[model samples]
Target chain A: MATRGDSAGMNGGGGVLLLLRKDWSIFTLRHRIFVLTVFLMAALQAVVVDEAYFLLGVALAAALAVYVPVIEWYQGTDPMLHSLPVKRGTVVAARHVVTILGMATAGIVWNTTGRILRPILGGGGSDPAFWMTLEGGLTYSLAVAILALLFFPLYFRFGMGRGIAAFAVMTLVLLAVGYGTAQLAAGPAAPGAVGLITPSSVIGSRVDTLLASVGPAATVTVTLAGMAGAFGISIGLSRRWFATREF
Target chain B: MDAVLELRNVCKTYEGFDLRDVSFALPHGYIMGLIGPNGAGKTTLIKMILNLVRPDSGDIRVFGLDAAEQGASVRARIGFVHEQPTFYEGLPAHRVATTVGPFYPAWDEAEFTALAREFGLPLRRKLKTYSHGMRTRFSLAMALAHGAELLLLDEPSSGLDPVFRRDILGRLSAIIAGGNTSVLFSSHLTSDLDRVADYITFLRDGRLEFTLTKDEVLERYALVKGDMSLLTAENRRLFAGIVTGEFGFVALTTNVEQARTALEGQAIVVDRATLEDVVYFTGRTGEGGLRLNGNTR
Candidate 1:
């Protein structure tokens, strides 16, 4: 049964690309009809909503497509995927690429829909300034990518169910901390203590000023660089964790 | 003959179990059955070979290449079927193959289709809808489609009906007839191996009990039954395990000839040991001492 074929059929880059293609094909087809149904429902609702709110549908579709596949992989495909000749990092990288592509496709659909429906909806359909702004686009992309950086490493480490649970726990902890800090500040007992550590107001003001002062191109570059760094670190941690995993 | 797979002093320790310094080589062109009881490190050993579990020490080689160093290349030559076949819940059967097909160099679509058809797998139905037996059949199809040199199957025949089990055993025999593929079948079903396995590797408590050809094992070990008076301390030393009954006593021994010599001129009967006898006796030895009291019930 051992065929006399080359084991190294693909180089490192080609293998990664092949894995990317595989992930894209599987994820898309697996969620194809659902994505289409969601898109149609959004289109039908476009008459009642503005272009900005309508574009949010893309995120919903993309998130559903990506999340469902991740959950399925946790159900059993992780070992099957790991068993393939591809490296663990390569698998993680390919899935990350698929996630990016799904988001990009969703973004394009949103933009195209906005452009076409602007006239009919009597919405600001073709404002080049709003549509072409790098600030909003890059900031949103960075935010999404950062979330992925956090979520994927956990998913790779503990699988989908535990990863989502951990994420929920972390979110709850942060909210509790935020609420406790607000309560402490509102209490007369800690008014001066709160004034001494008003991090949210100071950080928010500084972040707003910094965004305004930075050029669009510079902001985009910086955000991309940060996302890439975080992604690289996440992939490293994931590969290490996967390598030692007993399953 | 060269070994298709070799493990040298391979060791892996989990929270409660330990596979300590396990070593064996499976020669090419033969079916080697890895037999063990529950929690005997059978699945863990298979997982280690597949690089799913890293060994704490030692080496595993497939096709003369190190598993840890050249894992990807080594794995390309091996097809593995886990106890449970896991896939996307809603994905159709064919899509599962398609998604994985491109990763292997010699993936034959026609072969996969033929095998699927032969196995009666529902190509259009989602995997979640398939029965456990059907999923295993599908897993076997995928394993064969890639033209892998070595097949590592872990507990593959546990939850199947008798007809399907026999069919699977028949197919395994046919696969071995080709003289290129070597299978390492892990199972608790000794009867299935008695029919198909050329070699048997028995494990107990994460240790290798014995690794021998089927004929060699049958010729060596035996089941000896006799009166209780025949049960002496010297005779007890010969038994891998012993159990006393009201009628008489029965025990198993690896050195059947020696046992026969020791019990000569007595009302003792030594019969050829089935693989089942060897498994049960050797498998049950570690618990409550070798001198089992009363009925095994």
Candidate 2:
């Protein structure tokens, strides 16, 4: 029944960009009211509390990444997406793109706002030394990326509630691993180490020598490349799992 | 004839229900009513065409391209209204349209605007607030606004009132009258099919009974009524199905001409069958020679 010579009907004009924009639009839809309320709470926490300001923003960013794919799903539009011209792979790709961009945006916006507003609201610059550290930014990015990278495959595999449940279990495992890694990074907490993390700056020269040999730019490149590799693997798994799933 | 869509030996099996080698084609610029009772796999067939549900073994060609492999291209040319139409519910009707419009290359804002006005859709009203009929109208408007080659609708008119149902039927007739679009409308309501369908595809218990021109169905099939004395052994074989009541006996014959010639001068009357008669009779007859599949002659 391969009539019409096989190539007759492939004029697919829409791409992942179309789906990406649609996902972004959901934030402004019904969920925006709730999202704004949460943001105010996070901001108040940042201004009033001495700690958890920047982490609150990163946590919210990760929360959004988990929330977007499930938004239309709850609206009963998930099956509707399969009817659209976009490929399944394309849909998964746009979601991954949204997750990555969403994390970056939420993280940077929080960092910038915290820097400007924390001093104004408190009338003091009790900036923790770690907040002054770019290393803290690296840690924030890792947290954001790790949460998203881990959640998507589970989300694509198990749907929202189950996916989050699976993510919660994995989060516990990751927290344990992160605690172990933090212990290894700690030499001794440096002066004004922000009470959040044991200062990696005080770690002796063996780590510095390794970075020196690798070169700072090369070290940065390897970290980013590692993140990219993790994203690639997660995308592949999501695509494979979603392909056979019928609505 | 260049078919806009075709399915050949399409078989999908699930626990407790299956589409038993169903196959048919919609030639360019005609409406095919996929008529079936509940659980008859009409919706399943429509979903298979959309590639939302993959068939176990079959080939689906749309505009001559393999539907499973070239789904994006094939789906791009199709405008679908699901059994339960879904859109971004939180937004106003207009924004929902805007959000989906980009996916369709031929989407016309002006055409959508006109359709919204014609359907009395309050474009600024949030879609969640609209009634089911309004949502169906919006789905239809969206389906038509895109220059789709094929429209696959599943029970699209069930939610509308009789007045709007007639209005929507007229619109479908007009849409296909342009001679570029074909529709495969799946609905259990045969009266709607009788109104506008050029062809009728009957399904029962996940089996395709027949796909024939509406004219052929009306002309060939007939209803026969007579006294119980007319129920001779030879004459009983003439009827595809028979029902006995207190007053008399009524029967359905697939070939009214044969039944007419066979029963001449007897106390029996044979009249052309309505689409409803055909479905009810054949369904009563159960699974036998009713599977005409699609007429070749």
Candidate 3:
């Protein structure tokens, strides 16, 4: 029963919340199915691989987050969106907030379930299990934030079709570099000692060591800074792109 | 009187068509009917007013504010209904209203709910499930709910049944009776406009043919019916556009008095022209041997 006047005088935070409500309502049956499938897959993987599966689930969820904004952009609903009194930049920014929130929610559920099941499955002790789950969740959130920051601006500037092509090209170039790095790391002269040179192993060792060395506060600070920096850059680019757009 | 809306020398060019130097004004509290055939730039003109498409030149002032410079403020005061109703298909009518209504400062939920009930819109059902008529009604409810002073409708009656069209016109008339509200409806259906429009603006091939009050239009042109043999060279030239038949001759003339005077002895009958006849005659193509000067009647 909220009236129009009630929604007036909304600052950025209030606008983002209103936008989130609208986006949630607009998401259809197909979207629910897609989200459910991702969650189910992640749940099954968690049951099999314990804590590592939770991080994989977050990565997968973050990758899928791109679909929400991309679909909206391609639908060419700007005329309808612009018809409202909301500013164009606010509309663009709100989509990013909604996508990130959705991704975070999925990550929380995945990590929560993994935590509950770790003790029941008798995979590891509670201390290492707790720290591993926390580290995995943070890393997954950070990776997705980086991808969204790099890709969403491109999607906003160019339409979905071209944006997807650009994303694919960028992804392929990164993959090729990753492949070259793997070859150099696996060379005969290199140390093949267990838990030494692999990117995943190195990241896992550093994250656990960091969690142990500094308190959770330090780890959280670094993660918050990285997420904030990514969000800031993406928002800046999105605002610039939207201001010059004809619609 | 202060003009509610004014378009000065507006022009837009597409790949194959061009809207050139189109200009008109609607006084406050008057319903202006934009009458034209298909592809006559009616939608284009409305879009320009809405700032959905920027004009190549000229200025548009809405509610005494420049449209381009103050697009959001101008749009805030205007309500719009497109020919094809588009809404969030996933949301119910009530949710749709909840989502869209908050963006408008003047939106009235009570009014919207009342109108939705009056229009028999199913507030609980998703819009994609609504029939075409129901969707149009929902769109109308949304437009009216915002307490918008100026309503701009583009071909709103195109797909509607006559009964629904009449209901819409009746509701519009009641809305205009409030005295603070005005409407500019573009439609090919002349009968719909005849029922509610106070003024008429005719566009043909993207050019402004004329903009006149409904009474002035009726007075300015006369439909003449007479024998073909009685049609003289000078009188025929006076009739800007004419249709001849075996029974009699029918012609549209701006100076009804002059045509009547010149063809006094030869004429059979002369009657007042309707809005449809005025549009048809004025929209006729080049050089039909009818030279129109100033006011005809």
* DockQ comparisons of all candidates to the true complex: 0.39, 0.28, 0.30
CA-based DockQ, model 3: 0.30
lDDT of each: 0.73, 0.76, 0.74
Single-chain TM-score of chain A, each candidate = 0.70, 0.73, 0.73
| Candidate 2 lDDT by residue in tens digits, B160-273 | 999999998998999899998999998877899999999889888989889999998898789988776876778778877766655566778988878878878988877778
Clashing pairs for model 3 are B254-B296, B255-B296
Q: In candidate 2 chain A, where is summed lDDT lowest over 10 consecutive residues?
A: A1-10
lDDT of 3: 0.74
| Count of backbone collisions in candidate 2 | 0
Candidate 3 ranges with C-alpha deviation above 4 Å: A1-14, A28-34, A42-78, A113-139, A154-223, A244-247, B221-271, B278-283, B286-297
Model 1 chain B poorest ten-residue lDDT run? B283-292
Error of 1 at A68 (Å): 4.3
Instruction: Indicate the TM-score of model 2.
Output: 0.83
Clashing pairs in 1: none
Of all native A–B interface contacts, model 2 reproduces a fraction of 0.45
Candidate 2 clashes between residue pairs 3 or more apart in a chain or in different chains: none
The TM-score values for the models, in the order shown, are 0.84, 0.83, 0.77
Tell me the deviation in Å of residue A152 in model 1: 1.9
Measured with C-alpha atoms, the lDDT of residue A227 in candidate 3 is: 82
